[model samples]
Target chain A: MQPFIQFESVSKSFGSMTVIDSLDLTIHKGEFLSLLGPSGSGKTTILMMLAGFERPTRGTITLDGMRIDQLPPHRREMGVVFQNYALFPHMTVAENVAFPLEMKRLPRHEIARKVARALDMVRLGSLKNRRPSQLSGGQQQRVALTRALVFEPRVILMDEPLGALDKQLREHMQLEIRELHKRLGLTIVFVTHDQSEALTMSDRIAVFNAGKIEQIDSPHAIYDTPRTRFVAQFIGETNLIEADVVNVQNGHATIALGADLAAKVRSGPELQAGQKALFSLRPERMRLGAEPAGDNSLGMTITDCIYHGDHMRVQLARGNFTFTARCERLAGDWTVGTQVVVSFDPRDCTVLTS
Target chain B: MSRASARERMGALLLIVPLLAFLAVFFLWPLWTMVRASVVDNTVSRVLPRTAAAIVSWDGQGLPPAQVHKALIEDLRQAEDQQALGETVRRLNSAVSGFRTLLTRTTNAVRDETNSGAIDLGDLDRRWKEPRFWLALREAVPPYTDRNLLAAVDMKRDAGGAIVSEDPGASANRLIMFRTFLVAAIVTLACATIGLPYAMLAAAVTGWKRTVLLLAVLVPLWTSLLVRTTAWFVLLQNEGLINGALQVLGITDGPLPLIFNRVGVVIAMTHVLLPFMVLPIYSVLLSVPRNLMQAAASMGAGPLRAFWRVLLPLSLPGLMSGSLLVYMVAIGYYITPALVGGANDQMISSVIAFYALGTANWGLAGALGVILLLVTMILYFIYGRLSKSPQLLGA
Candidate 1:
């Protein structure tokens, strides 16, 4: 996997405020990578720097082993789809899609053929003559996508492209974009704050926080094994418990939840004995039963039980400690004030030092 | 309609009553009067009522019959208002150019004679026997005439009542009209060339920078038009700052002809009318989404190409409206050109002003005014159609 695009020690700032701080990142060829974070977290800035719309305050960016930091956006050979589709209003759909080809100074007949084929590929052949205002939201999004793809540049960058659509339409577009990425084998860098969207669409997700990448891994690995507390909390639901490491042996450590409760958990390299640590336990990993065969168990009372469509979220409490467990809907009618035993396999818990 | 809604509509109508009355009195009434004055003439008929009637039956070939001459003498003797008689003489003199002396002398002669019946007007003045004099009288006999309107365009009816162009060197109204349009078009082009880039610069910035740019355009607009034109007048003089600077910079051997010419008129008018061009373009550029340029760049369009394809097209509505506005205002300009232009460079408005106020030829003034009004209406129609397009709104 050769790196197709690289940002080497990049730092971007506006006046005195820094948006990206000494960042180093690599994007492989034909890989779908997403930069996911909340607003003002600089995820969009990284995408913009890659697209050559913004110059880095320091350091350099290279694409295909060539320096592209100084190049203008037009010469960067990357297609960008904006949040609000910036389609040319004065031009019809066909003309809008043919803009890049015409800029490339391609022959007239060839440009027309490419524009027509691209429009047909997106199922917008009937809308070739319509202006962007005459089209629906979803249709405009499709036209924008087609226009960006018609040029077939080195990579495609999308900045919250589907944020304006309704829920159902957004989900549909998410899958459509994923399909397009796969069929074209494009090296795409997508920016979004929607964690689930990044998870469902990207081959790798870079969870960003405060202008730096917290974790970069496959979506499953990122969700199942987050490297930091921010990544774990940002990705999905989890219960974090303050604990002290009691002992460490090989790749696992024993952490004491309280004076009377202790649990064995898998730890990363930074954990050691006699140090304060945070233990992360996913809600779905806990089992609500009197199962004595598990490596860890605790006796608590059900304080609240919330019914989801397919699962039950039972909140349990024991003295000062509180935990939530997601269990099967038919897991024996757990309700508030019902005493229950919560257990989990030690392999499902992760020990965090920060 | 429901009671409440109907009451609301009534309230809205009442709110607009003052505005409607103002438009009717101050705008529409004057417009109507001017239009009527261009084609309606009754000076001859009012002074010589019986003569006007008697001359209608005359063949208008060689001379009038004896009864028509007797009727003229009777009408002239009975015309007691001296000012009214003078007005009639003045109106007829404009056509034949000798009635001022001829009518005044004849009026005195007819009044002094005790026997007022059967007076032969040829006995008083042999010039009256000339067929041209009677022809001028016959031409003036019509209460409604196209003389002023035809004269506005430098065309007139011959003795046989056929329309023909005025003799060469006789009048320069038509030449001045064409020059007015030409000067306006030149000024419009200058404004567009300078205004488009200025508007884009204003739109590209934000915060205080944008405020500064807009203020640069607006400060000039807030000043009086005459004051601005006067400022240009001082600057364009040969011994003024512009020439002094040019001399210091060694751009030319001597001061160029920067005043009382086409160049001076164009420069001053462009400066005076630039805000009209810039404001519309700036507003339209503001409404256009800023990301379109970036989108073009992302799609492999350089700055020039992106501007030509995306930004320029998007801002075209503003450019067109600005050009039309400048052109319309430029054609009607009087003070600037009069102050800064040479005598030969005066536009049609100067001619209209001379007719309206200088010579008091209100008929010709109104006719020229009607021509200008028609041109403005056509341009406004085009502007209305352009603005109605969805593209103009940046949809």
Candidate 2:
């Protein structure tokens, strides 16, 4: 099927500065795609371009095979949830929801029925007469969501919609939004700087770095097999070590860390003999013991041991590199200042390049 | 109430004592004095107390009884002895046109004669035989009458205690009052129409542009009212820059009648009051979140619809306050109208000034002032109630 929205060679520049450069992306219908990055990574600019709030300095954006780059924001037929909800303070919840319908010049009775149904969807029906100021933060967010959806726009854009809520409420709202997206089968493009939010809510996450997509994949694949050094460090905690490729074979290579330390990692085309490359090892994948059991193992001195409720974080140092390893409490305690062998399976380690 | 709370309340009251005293002495006292002066017709009763008392019961159809005549003669002799007859004559003359000369002629003829019954007052001045003169005296007899208040509205009570419009030959105060309100309303409307968009632009901009716009609005407020009015006077004159520019542009074949007219008055007043309208509106517009407009657009509203549906209602309180400020100030404006307006375009404030300083009719001035004050107070009361809502105060 053709992509629901297509961004073709889009670039945005402000005077002497470039915010986005030669970017291309596609969003599928009924998919919850998240653009996740740190601040100033041009993720918001892409979202703004898609919502028709900002125009690209070069190239075009198309919605379902129609060019929408020149369209004004009101004519774009896209619903957007702002970070602060942006509910009209002068209007009540129902009035705010009815505003888009009224702009469309729908019949008053149909508008009222739709407004009531939209409020009921957000469970804010009783607050139809209460102004935005009277509602709590979460309720206001629901009202804003209801308003954005009440007009039945084909696509929804959320720009850090849960950024203002507390952690507990943020998680709750994320689940609620995901449930709504699934039930309605509405295409959504969500932008957030929080990696965990992207992980928890999106069907697919596009990691952004410095005006480019670092990687795009499912949350499991993104966390398990990050393609670049930036992505490996950005998404989750990992132990990275610079190693020289000693030998390359079919689909795998042996990497030498320091003297007497060698590990097998999945190899990329950039990994050649006697060349330096970074290897990413998950903290939870490594185990501490006196004897090595996995395909790859290394001898290290335990520098520190931190007691977490579920697992102990064991810090190991070997030849100018420290690795953090999460050891389950079921595993026997390893004291600090003791030498141990840390081991991981070859399938769990991936080689990353700059 | 508990003693401690009561004592605390007393402390609060004590803290406000100086301000309350200041307001009473400076504001309320003057207002009370104006109200009293508007109705206090004491000159006639004070000078001719017996005659004033006698005429209250007299049928106004004919001349007052002989007893009233005798009392008036006694009062006139007493007033002449004290050298106070001139004041009474002047006061009575204001009510009826020729009373001062008539009273002076009769008093001069009767002053030296000791027999109050021997002299025929009608022979000295046949005008005394007319009951209209007596009716005028009776009109002024009451210590407090609505004559000044009625005259303020261009109406007065006739001899039969019926309210009637004052003589049309005299100046019509009601027309002046109507013109004052109309001019104020027009100036207010002009200020809102021009200032609203200017304020929105100023509020919507940022950096040096906003600063420049704000300074442009505020700098004019520092200039003296007289200087500004004079500036308009120079610009709007027939031979001045505006007419010269118009002629140069070939918009008119000759100089337009711009100065000393209603148009000039409204333009100058609107310029002066525009800042009052703009500042409040700018502050309100600044407080409105920019995201709301974006939300409106994202929800399928055009720019105008967003402004109308979300922004305008939010800024209404500011507009209301600005309108009230412009209107109240415009109605009481004196210098600008005096400099730029013609005789026919002069507002009620000019009339008040003419009555108070030009003709020394303080009672009439005080009456017109009371009316203006009452109208302003009523408007302020309504505004206060309407703005008591916290939503109007904003989030």
By TM-score, the best candidate is 1
Clashing pairs for model 1 are: none
Chain B TM-score list for all models: 0.88, 0.84
TM-score of 1: 0.92
Tens-place lDDT per residue, model 1, A183-220, is: 99999899999999999999999999999999999999
**What is the per-residue lDDT of model 2 for residues B164-223, given as tens digits with 9 covering 90 to 100?**
999996867999999999999999999999999999999988999999998888876888
True contacts kept of each: 0.79, 0.74
lDDT of each structure? 0.90, 0.87
Pairs with steric clashes in candidate 2: none
Cα lDDT tens digits for candidate 1, B1-395? 89999999999999999999999999999999999989889888888988889999988778999888888888988998888888899889988888999998898888986755666788879998799999899889788889889998999998789999999889888999999999999999999999999999999998999898878877877888778877876797889889989999999779889999999999988877898999999988988888899999999999999999999988999999899888888889998889889998899889989999999888999999999899988988888887667764546
Task: Supply candidate 1's per-residue lDDT for A239.
Answer: 92
Q: Report DockQ per prediction, comma-separated.
A: 0.65, 0.56
Candidate 2, position A144, lDDT = 85
Q: Write model 2 residue lDDT over A239-297, tens digit each, in one string.
A: 88888889999978999876777888877677788887888899999988889776777
Q: Taking the candidates one at a time, how many backbone clashes does each contain?
A: 0, 0
- What is candidate 2's CA lDDT for residue A63? 95
Q: At residue B67, what lDDT does model 1 achieve?
A: 80
Interface RMSD, in order shown:
1.3, 1.4
